[model samples]
Target: MTLPLPRQRRTLGRTGLQVSPIGLGCSGFWGHRRFAEGAAGRVLATALEQGVNLLDTGHNYSGFNAEPRLGRLLAPLLATCPREQLVISSKGGTLTGQAGLGGTEQRDFSPAAITASCEASLRNLRLEYLDIYQLHGIGEHQITDELLGTLQRLRERGLFRHLGINTHSRGTLDWLAANPTVFDVVLLDYNLLQQDRAAHVAQLHEAGMGVLAGTVLAQGHLLPYRPRLPALSDAWYLARAWLKPSSRRLMRSASKMRRAVASIASQAPAQTAFAYVLQHPGIAAGIVGTTRTESLLQILATDPCLLDAADRARLVAVFGDGRGSPSV
Candidate 1:
């Protein structure tokens, strides 16, 4: 039997912003290929029309073009949807305009760089202030008193309402857990194949900071094997996928999960993957960033997807935190 999904919103930490269970990630990194304006705009329109109000983007997404693109598309939507109703969160700290296709992003969380990036993002999005502004992919060391002071000054200046951070590091989460006052939101990488940080997610929640799971789809790697791309997209995604060693181990064990999962009859693997993430405790929403509208539709189709205790335990036995078999 098909279960109905919830249409409610969850509190985004102490910021008091209510967001949908599915947030649209505007990274524009689909295979590192060019995303046409028409298609991108269509994705944005369809998402909003379908009740998705959270748009997650960053300063360097799509080589520094995602923000402006979103700006142009959002202008028309604002005519109907109140700006406050849509929670637009963006990240900076990653250096923009760097050469190369899907190469490493140089992070610049320095006060000067962050200040400039936030200001430029405000200008690009054509907004007075962002709902949430994050420091993209920085370590705990970067989260110093000076950085706090810098963000405080910017927040005081009305650049943004809440502070956020985007990271895949558990250590970073631990640091934030020790000092949850540092940020109001966290964009984390958690998916069926990468579940090691589940506990830390709860910690952030306990500390009153919202957690948005990024890469919930694992860059589409969690799906069964598919044919190679004709271009560099596959190469880029594969290379970056190795960055998460645990995921690498999980990929080795993926064939086991590729088999039929119990209780979920005839459902798509994409939906199952999404369900596992959203159902995880303390996860506000799962962020999906695909250029294809169909992919987003599939994810939304499973809004508040269900995975009972048996399903959860079975997933752990299979994925095992994406780490190899338990140590002896």
Candidate 2:
């Protein structure tokens, strides 16, 4: 079946890269137990056909297999299409030492590591340069002057069209804003579950930085199959068996609450979550990851016009505002 085309493109931070308002996160296409070799190419082709011009992946995803997978898939497509028509993004500052369900681990962001990672990614991606190269989350100690200098040099050399950092910390966002020219984009974890970064987002936008949102699905906890923790009551368990996490651990009361929220929100989960992020003023795009081609297609098929205030309120009630209370 044919997927719906995106209606508009958004400017990617200050890089001036125009991308589909919703982009594909390529992590799901690699390292997962269910991801097949050919699936990545199929999904990517489908995404392009559906008018998704932005594809986000990282070196750490799938033990460095993600970029290569994307390269194999995108090579043929790139040969035919003008390179400027697509936006490709990848991250460094982490490494996948092994390949398995959870073999990936974070690496330090030394200047040497950053430089080495970029060169390796270029080779893996089979591209002369990346459209965007983001520094995955790193501690303050890791964000050294040397590393920043290296990023600046990479920019000067045209190794990447733009530089960015991905983080969930407000302090990091604040720091990056203070030194705006050091980075072009900032990928943050923003969703209905967390609004603490709302103010930071506004700040970044004011500084002319691109803001891309990840974890919009909260690492799949918001899906129908999330497992219940032991703390949850039997009533909650019964109500949300379908939403159980892939791995069932000792349930927690918070698990019950989470399941309750998921149950209520599942009626229109994708619509609610996607709309919640899209409503944010500074969000250039929402980076959604999914293993299922149909799920990606569903996101593409959604009518941007359907998200309304009532839907926003329902999402707020389910996930709550940054404050401890539900926005409802």
Q: Evaluated with lDDT, which candidate comes out highest?
A: 1
lDDT of 1 by residue, 15-81 (tens): 8888988889887554132656787787876787678888898878777888888888887767665
> Model 2: per-residue lDDT, tens digit, 102-205?
42245768878889989888888888899999988765456778888888898788889888888766678778878877778998877655655677788888
Where model 1 places Cα greater than 4 Å from the true spot, the runs are 1-6, 30-33, 96-103, 226-253, 260-266, 303-305, 321-328
Assess the local accuracy of residue 229 in candidate 1 as a C-alpha lDDT between 0 and 100. Answer: 45
Which lDDT value does model 1 have at 91? 88
lDDT minimum window of 10 residues, candidate 2: 245-254
TM-score of each: 0.87, 0.81
The Cα local distance difference test for each model comes to 0.76, 0.70
Residue-level error in angstroms, candidate 1, position 244: 8.4
